[model samples]
Target: MPGSGRLVDVVDTTTRDGNQSLWGATGLTANEILAIAPTMEQVGFHALDFTSSTHMSVSVRFHREDPWELIRLMRAAMPRTLLNFITTGMRFIAWQPCDEEVMRLAFRCVVRNGIRRFQFAEPANDPSALRRVARMAREEGVEEIVVGLTYSISPVHTHAYYAERVAALADCPDIDRFYLKDPGGLLTTDAVRELGPHFAATGRTVELHSHCTIGLAPLAYMEGLKVGFDVLHTAVGPAGNGTSQPTAESTLRNLAAEGYEHDLDPEALGRVSTYFRELVREKRLPPGEPREYDAAYYHHQLPGGMVTTTQRMLEEIRRPELFDAVLAEVVRVRAEMGYPILVTPVSQLVAYQATRNVIDSERWLNVSDETVRYFLGHYGDFAAPPDPDVADRVLSLPKVGKLREAEPIGLEGVRARFGRRISDEELLLRLTMPEEQVDAMRAEPAIAERSVPVDAGDRAPLVRLLREIERRRQISYLRVQKGDDLVVWRRAS
Candidate 1:
């Protein structure tokens, strides 16, 4: 079969995996999560793959969670579309005993509330326990249960061990498919070409979850499709974490060009991806790109510190000093952490990079050492600085600068009050400075280069303008046409 003919299901991970941990950033709001759902469905993806219950609830503001609860909100929001969610009792780091009963209840609640597709993984490497969880899910009428094998950050096991787990799935009636979920994006392509077909032929159906952690997921996904794989997961926006998900739209675009037919259309899917990318830039999110821009992506991260938490450890060297040594350390830290040095969450990436870059360069090593210690002490506490606001903007945005968290508020409500006439990026900056100061910043109009500080006046408007430019670029994806005023999703022309 040509590549397109073989591609079938596309599972989206924007909400679950994308939001909870953004690249070089932190978790997204429930509304932020909800905001993307309809677009995801619009992309013709087979499922939404909502995030783990453990990840989502903790990240959401507590109060705004009631009506239109994220899950319920998304379900209701995309009523006609097919979507599924996965909740894990399994901790990625190591196996810990969790109340299987609690896990079951969470599953039941999510399923009853609208989540149809569910995944069950072992807390540790206990494949045996997962079978039991699968059995429970089967009892609950979940037709498709995904069991994870070789997920990143899970107990690292050999291919042989993974084969053994694949064998173990035969015991669970609920398990319709098994996944090789490399969340840390650690899978090697050679392993994929060899193992992907191997798993597909294992007399068991399989799903493949790969990432661009070391930068090979897109090719790996292609290899999976070529080698006989089924559903593959991806994110529609640049807001996705670790490795980007392979979108149905992009893959379908390739398929259409190659004369392949799919259950869904590429043009329709493109419309959604466009909407999603807009959300990223509109919110000052790190932009997602194809292979060429990976290094630039890290260099261009919004808040710089999140990208350089390790570099901060290196002795600050003048330009003449060779950066080879510093770069080497970054690679080492990345390998040790099993993830990239730069992950992108919406607000956090810019804030982190901004903080890191502007931080006194003279104190780089001192800060690096402290950040390294913190990273080591708290490996996955990626969401450490929940929110931080500048001193002057505190009262106006009670929810802005929280280092931890506050009762969650409605992102929809906030946007509604502010007027969507301003983009997410503009809203963030608008909250940061006074109107008069904003105009002054817009007036002087020095571009944001190398993180220089502006007088409150120049600073506010400049921030607004930068974000406005970004939002404009993302919106350009839906280019206007001759007859129609708006660019929209339509059947292939």
Candidate 2:
């Protein structure tokens, strides 16, 4: 097992994928990432799945941190390894069809800032749309384009179905490799053994990206490796098990026992894991514990990040008990809606409609605007045509007809929507999010990079906590009060 020369590449998705699972969707601020990035750079992984347009929006909208700043910092920290970003076809971060200019500029911005590779996928599996985006991205200096075969179980998504699509993807000129993305961790070991080889047969480098949601990802990964995948996605300690990808430490151990060699340094990766494990403990964040195999996950096919978000949405409506029912409805609705692979946009659309159906007792009564657009073919053609009755019901809504008549925004339209005063990159950000939010982001100064203390809770020093306030002195008086404590301070002009 010392050096069999069957080398594998380990792509880490901790900052992006793990943050989505453990921390909320936009968790893991830039400061937190910078603290551990240098260590991860030394771990010898192939690349880091770092950030995305969704991540950028989340950073500015919720965390008030600059997303570009994150890229710049991470690029400087990990100058040796490649950075991977996720994108949907012709869209930056939103669900609707985005302007062509916005998409082009965003692609260039991502690459210019340091993302050397991109993982592109859309739920509808529109090869032409993917090729279009890839062509533009290639022109804009993106080094590697990784198109994904998003995995799910459905009559329309059989092995034959994927083999044909994989063949088509192989012909895609801009695609450097392919990824079999099982975001839901829904693939069985046997299924992977059958499906994995198809991707490799494409004559392009292929990788397996899956979640540990159903506890079958590791097994599925082994099967994929047996079939000759060139790379596997994994994460470090707190970011790895549970609903996230399998831990790199465990995967390396598995490979060593199987008589294979990988480029990664187990000792360096272990230190990275140690850092995150401590971070999880100090922050009271959930650890990526191995989950028991749950048969229900096959039906829901909800990714790790979505599981928490869906739960929160249910809790907000005071219908937490209906969570299981909602999941079931998702399966039924997905089948009715043509079995689109349950990844983002489609996954979110189906989940929303399912929750509505479960709560309202009247299916499709209050359909979301996005669902109507999906039914009308604004996103793209589905794998299978939608159930006729469901389609009729969706279109019967007052706004669906008008939405269908709308056209995709072009470069000129984008320029008209936002003035030419700002740089193309800034305009792209403004177009991706609400103008008011972008304004707020621009108004806020960049946060100085610093180490994030996980357990600052009540033990944090008052002076250190209120350092921002201390900088403002206009003959000010300050007082703080907690449950059973009070402190006061005054200063003369």
Candidate 3:
């Protein structure tokens, strides 16, 4: 990730945040993690974000066996890869870190385990929480601390506010590096541009943890580079798709095109992309695309190019037509507020770059001169510079204001809508919600029923696919109502 004498360290999170949404459907094994380790190294990523020991029971067990042992093994396996970890935190990492002593235990996991670096996704709105976490990291002698912006949760907040919160942490004697964590999968390059100066002001170096939820990670990262981020978080292609982050391939390619000397090998990136794609494809998974290529991919494959979350929504919701309505409502709200309601920055870029391809897109694009300049900084010379077109077309894109503001749903409703078999992660992602939302999603029958069904062409494909999924045993059949139609024995598996 070293580019132009500026050592831009890259963190490859393909198996971690990059696969958060996919974890429900597919949990990579130790071998799977190991297999991709080389791919990461091949791609010239400075390091692999490794795994979150705090995520699940299996991962915890893996951590307990001596992280050093595992790191040593991975190190031996992919000697070139930098293995890192995010020990424990507020979210899925529900480790028994009941007290401050637990913090020491987490720290030991890093140093004793050959884990050179570590991070915790510090939500921007929660400065107190971030400071506490940062203080602990510093106390533990942790080499580097990446402060995650966790951008998606508080989209309503401004760039200045986030910078202020992160900047405050910069002075914390215990920390080394800072970062922006765009966990909600909603980050944009332009947003990064607006953010870089604030982080740079901190005097401490800053890093960025972006996502490809709406696919602008590469661009966001590039913007961060223009503003000068010391490190950039990324992943291999395709696996770095929706719910993932900007891919190493695209980021490197962008840097390369700009005539930067990336210390990591570009050929290695290509190899890793191929390696990752084959595995994902074999896993019966979808391919991840770089935001840089999303416009091309979106133009070439709109129906398939849609994010997994949106596709899941299509499958779980009742009113097939409601998607359009939901998007329209989103557009109406965004237009009313004066911007395109893009899920992320790249989604806006793709919309601006490929108008006819995005779904009912034209109405939501509210691109402005400022946005086009940002695009130019990231995408380089456009045969047709998107700046003016972006400004002209920004309002033309569609929005999802209604869906974004949707209230918590219920469980019996969950049983009816997505079926009782829906994994907690899938349910949360599809609903654009949290685990607690599941409790609500199960309570109301109508709310659940209001969702789209996980439809297959017929019972045969459905049954076979269900059986293939390990969760088939967890599902329960139920009834659902859609307009004048009601169906019984409706299965979620």
Candidate 4:
């Protein structure tokens, strides 16, 4: 009712978050994304939740494509729309924390590559870290900086807790807005009603980014709109729903029903959706579907990606029956470790510990090196004090001293280790990834043309075969014969 006359903005997450959610972040290649770029530009999104540092690393490791080129090409194709880059604020592509100079260089490279909007979250929700990163992004010439108030369900993550964070950030001039990031899809309508006002009171623009993992995001979006959230993050077609964000089509329909206005063109949105739907069918990738409410998901509070990863790990180990038990163990592990918001490294750490607990005879017997680092305060301060017994046991480990003495590799050291003659983009990749992976990426041929195959209906198999032949550059000619029918194609060269 409060948003009756308001024009809501939309951030399209199809390329980044949706891809990660539905396809493990390797769904779209530069060629495929570029083909749809012109259409996406016509959709009137406030920003494209385009890429994160992790996605950039993924591009090099999986697609062997230049991520900087991808960003540059997308910017040229969609000059009117803002391309956003999200990060953890503590690290770049690598999991280990980097020196300030390294982060500064990373930000410089990111902004230089045409990322106008910068969004980041400190895993621990540390206000000081948020402020520091916001300053860094601003200094690097990022036009917009959005801080994520990561949402989680814990005794320590109350309204008061978030309100203090909001208050702390109120004085920061560099931060443009606050994004209520519910990565776990744990935000309910009631939670929005409660937390929305605090963010609104910040006098900064507020955006809502939630997943449809547990079927709560759509409901939460409506409630968020009612409570002064100015922007909603959504995806299109196969990229939306299920574990991804709410579908743009459905969210827009709901917005119209509530008498809210937005700038999105329905025809343009449909075209984008159609492209993705076809792509999903062609690639044989899993399409995002609407999820049913699951109460157990709220208990474990693992993000969508973690749940899938854990299931796959358990199945691989031939212990698929232990899936539910692992989920249960996650709750205890999360509490013992102080209720980290289920995102990136923290979520992975918690899930790893949970799986180990379920598999091993003892709970803390097989702690990961990262877990040891986390408990030692390498990540950031814990939201609350961890279980004293568990913390003591973890701290007493022999490797703690070595981990404590380890320093983040400096930017100068990285450049020296890699070559000084290489470009900053190449240097950044080499800094975080293994040299062999970078070498493999370099060895791969560039994507010079659109690789997405056109749908051929009943003849799709034949078309696929032809496309495969085209990919094998060595094949200059092809012939096919069946019964009395014969078909032949030859390359011009």
Candidate 5:
């Protein structure tokens, strides 16, 4: 095989990150994911990120599937590869913090369920909080710890700020790698040109984890590779491109051109893509595709996952036309209320506040409880403080006083509320949510029916092409170009 001497490991995030983009976070059922696990394993990816505490809650809340079972199934199918989880350090996936004992028990449950890798991220860039949990992840037998330096654009999030944080992680013995995570897909090539080399200079293995929201992730990946990133996180074709990472096929070609070697079997990866293409067509699910760059995204900075969700919320109120207005409001809301890094809970909170500002006749008249809690410093620290006038208004709200008086529940409180004899998994779930919701999850069915039947026309060509390719073991590479579209596949010799 012709290759670049330097090896680059490909970590696929289709099942995990792709779900966040395409399915509003809980779209794929446990059975659907399990069916594709073996093929993903065959693709020879360095690692596969399967779930997070957020996705686990999504599983039980929306899919009625046991998250523990999902982890076990994925681990069983991909025994040779590391199974990964995403976490917000000690918070354990809830919007608020949890007791240390609760976090410790959750780590044990994940490790016992066969998750070998943990991707710890703290949006606030607080290393002390992460250290408390990273040690626990290691103590519980996790083999790999990838800390995410979440990417965002703000006054406090300059290139120097990120470089300092990455360097700080070097002292943590449990951190094996650092991930430059662009959850909003906001990283541009110019920024990557400067930031990439500085990250390489950290003298630690760095992985570029970005999204395709504004379509610059591919360009960013190329720049990162040229500057010496050790790994690139991407997703398979039918599950990639638009809101997810760039397609593996295109990335492989670009990396090969740059003299990098990847162990991924492209032909096997194509088969995996083929399965999803057919599955989406049959289920009438949306197929992920590359999107043109949108400059407006720079101001809104809503991730691909949040874009779809905010769109749905707009439609629900019959004010879909106001979607752009909400995006515009998000820019203002983020500025007035401290410039927090836009990821997960923060991103969701910003959007919620913006939605109220756009819909209500009076500005700030209908703030969400979460937004009030944010002003109360419940969601960790922010890079900047809220505007003076905005701070006074938020502080004066009656809800702020009520929230301050409310005591947070610790491990003993959780046991008192849910009982001590309950298994750790059940206790952890209840601790993050109400007991009624967990009970409903236990009573509901495992899976839901597909939204629509598969179309024969949509599935035939790809299905036939894959079967033919499977019959030709002697072929090492396949390239097909039609119009401006190009596809490439490589098989193990």
Candidate 6:
């Protein structure tokens, strides 16, 4: 109400975070993304949260598609929109920390491909680490560097704590702006009112990227617009509500209702949404739906994806009943480990340890290698001091000594191992992923030219059948005939 006639910027997260949230990061292929890219460009989005190292790894490991090709194709298809790449600051596809040269090269390769905007978050929220990463991306010629002020609910993460972190980066010339990244969707209306001014004080453009895991992000986003945030991260259609960012269509409408204007074409947005909706239906993928408020989510703070992953892991071990126990242990494990913000790597580490505690008879009896490295300072300084007893127990383990003494391989070393003949894009993939996975990706055939069926009418079922038959190597050909209609597809040798 106070900011009537103000214009807001919208960043589309459908391809990246939304895909990860609703479809487990493997939903859209290069063909699917390319099919809808032209229409997405018609909608005036500030940027497309396009890809990340994790998503790239997902492409090779799951779809056997070259991620570089996806970027190049998408860039060509949507030249007007900025493609964004988000990172964890310290690592690439692998969770382990990499040498500075490796990270620098990774950023260079990313910018070289098509990513113009870079957003990074340091799990520990270390200002120095964030500043260094920002400079690295800048040096690599990234157009915009957005540092993330990762949000969490903990005694140590107060408004003053965040303000101090923001102030620490106030003089960072390499950083173009700051984003309040709430991966857990834990931010509330009250929290926004309290924290907005501190972020605004930085005198830099600030954006808000929050998830709707517990049904609070949309409301928080509305309140955030009233605060200092000007740009909001949203997903398109099937990718937007439950675990992902707020939907772009609803966000734009709400913005208008609240006297703010966004420069997105509703018709274009509708087309993009319809494409994804049909894709979801055809693929039988789960669509993001509105979630009821879950008050208990605040205590554990596991992001939506992690929760689903943990459940699957439990089910895999035939211990689905241990879900509640693992979650409860997550709360305990997080506190003992100094309440690191439940984001990537950290969140994963906490969840892993919690699962182990639930499965084993004793807590901390068996620690993961990553957990050992985390406590050994390989992941940067802890946000807060860990429980003294727990730290002693973790540090005393034999694995900690080896993890502390080991050094991550440098870029040249990686090149030597993988051979310098391969392209930087492939080399980066090999450096972070398993050799067999990369090899399989290389051996796989080119993704088919078939597009997702949007308006196929009765032909949709036939398209689905063809895709299924294509997956089976033993099936050489498929022929379908109904009434006077007949179609035959033969697999290429």
The prediction achieving the highest lDDT against the true structure is 4
Clashing pairs in 4: none
The global Cα lDDT (0 to 1) of model 4 is 0.88
- Per-residue CA lDDT of candidate 4, range 352-440, in tens? 99999889988898888889989988899888889999999988988988987878857766656777799998898888888888898
Instruction: Kindly report which residue stretches of model 6 are placed more than 4 angstroms away from their true locations once superposed.
Output: 447-488, 491-493
TM-score, model 5 to reference: 0.88
How far is each candidate from the true structure, as Cα RMSD in Å?
A: 14.5, 5.3, 15.9, 3.5, 9.2, 2.8
- What TM-score would every model get versus the actual structure? 0.57, 0.89, 0.56, 0.92, 0.88, 0.93
Clashes of each: 29, 0, 44, 0, 2, 0
Best by TM-score: 6
Q: How far is candidate 5 from the true structure (C-alpha RMSD, Å)?
A: 9.2
For model 5, state the Cα shift of residue 258 in Å: 2.2
Clashing pairs in 5: 4-259, 282-454
- TM-score between candidate 6 and the true structure: 0.93
Q: How far does residue 152 in candidate 2 sit from its true spot (Å)? A: 1.0
Q: Please, what are the lDDT tens digits per residue for candidate 5 over residues 55-152?
A: 99888887777788778877987898898998877566577766677777888999998899999878687777777778888888889988888888
Instruction: Please report, as a residue range, the 10-residue window in candidate 6 with the lowest summed lDDT.
Output: 450-459
Winner on lDDT between 4 and 6 is 4
